[model samples]
Each structure stands twice: as C-alpha cells, then as structure tokens.
Target: MSSSALPKPQMRDLLANCLRFHIVGAIIVSLEVAASYEFGVAEPRKKAYADSTKTMIPHKDFEERRKPGVFQSTK
Candidate 1:
C-alpha cells in the first residue's frame, strides 16, 4: 500500500508514535547517564561494554568469522 492512500489521522498517529518513542528513549538514556556518573564505576562499565559488544568485520552470512578482538585491555 502506498503512503498516499493512508488517511491524515493515520499519518498523524504514526508521527506521534515516533516522537513518543524518541522522547522516551532520550529520557531513559539521560537517566542512565546520570546514574552512571553518580555511581562512579564508569571504567568498569566501559571495560564490560568493550568485552561484550563485538565489532565484527564485514563477512558473508554463510561464513562465520566470529573472532574476539584482541585489543581490549580488560581481557
């Protein structure tokens, strides 16, 4: 279905939903940042994040090149 076929209310609802989602996300992220600063464990959290989130090199989906990065200081 093309967007032009949709009613104005539907478009308004879609835009409102998107705005609400972004606002909620921003508030949650701000709260997390405030908590992180108050707790003062940024270094440990950074190391943990570095260990968990992988930066995978581009590869075909059929081939699994699951290699852990070697540069993490915590490792």
Candidate 2:
C-alpha cells in the first residue's frame, strides 16, 4: 500500500501528546534540580545563575510553540 493510504493525524491530538511529554520532562528536570539542591551537589553560585537564567514561558505559549512537525530539544 502507498503512504497516502494511511490515515491523517489531527493537530490537536499531536499537540496534546507533545504537551504531555513536555510536562513529564519538566517534572523530571524539577526533581533533579530539587535533588541536587537537597544534596548540596550544586554550588550556590551555579544555582543562583541557573535560577536567574531560567526561562518563565507560560504553559499556553509553550504548548503553542511546541509542535510535532518541527525539531525540538530532547535533552
């Protein structure tokens, strides 16, 4: 069968899935940050710098910008 025979996907569903993954990733990152903070592994200066440089994008904006069709950072 040709590729065109496959069913087309909905953008809303794709965005929802991407949002779910992003949320899960953010949770994991937050946990790591918390763990480092608790263990004192991260230096105060580094932590302060990280906190200062952290982006504060809203959830709605993040969801709007993150789409499956574009390249995204998975790190």
Candidate 3:
C-alpha cells in the first residue's frame, strides 16, 4: 500500500473546477444585483401614482353632500 494508490483528483483538475464554479457564482450575483436595481428604480414612479390617487379625494363638504347611490360616478 502507498499514498499514491489512493484515488484522488489531480490538483490542476480541482483548481479548474473551483475556478469555474466561482466564475458562475459571480455572474449569478451580478444578475441579481441588476434586477434589484431595476426594481428599486421603479419604486418612485409607483409612489407618485399612489400620492396622486390620495390627493384626488373630494373635500369634506363635497364628500358630505355626495349621493350614496351605487351608480355614482367620479367627475
């Protein structure tokens, strides 16, 4: 029995595999970062729309005098 008899991957093969894995991992991380940035960029537009909707509500007197009918329309 000798140390060389044991089945093991060559150092070069192991290093190559590790390098490939790291490269793939880096690409995946970059894509995730880009997607997160795009989503964050759209948030302000969404917030603006939400703010406009809130401000479109009628004032207190108009709200009080508005009809309670089901077919009411917003002008």
lDDT of each: 0.69, 0.75, 0.78
Q: What TM-score does each of the candidates earn?
A: 0.39, 0.41, 0.43
Tens digits of per-residue lDDT, candidate 3, 2-67, equal 667767758677888998999999999999988887788777788889998888756754766565
Give me the runs in candidate 1 sitting further than 4 Å from their true place.
1-10, 41-75
Off by over 4 Å in 3: 1-6, 42-75
Judged by TM-score, which candidate is best?
Answer: 3
RMSD (Cα, Å) for all candidates, in order, is: 18.4, 24.8, 9.0
- What is candidate 3's CA lDDT for residue 50? 90
- In TM-score terms, candidate 3 sits at 0.43
Q: What are the per-residue Cα lDDT tens digits for candidate 1 across 16-64? A: 8999999999999999998978678877788778876565444542234
Model 1 TM-score, 2 decimals: 0.39
Query: For residues 1-75, could you state the per-residue lDDT of candidate 2 as single tens digits?
Result: 676776776756888899999999999999998988876856777888788668555665566666653437721
How much is 19 displaced in model 3, in angstroms?
Answer: 0.9
> Which of the predicted structures, 1 or 3, would earn the higher TM-score when compared with the native?
3
lDDT of 1 at 4: 75
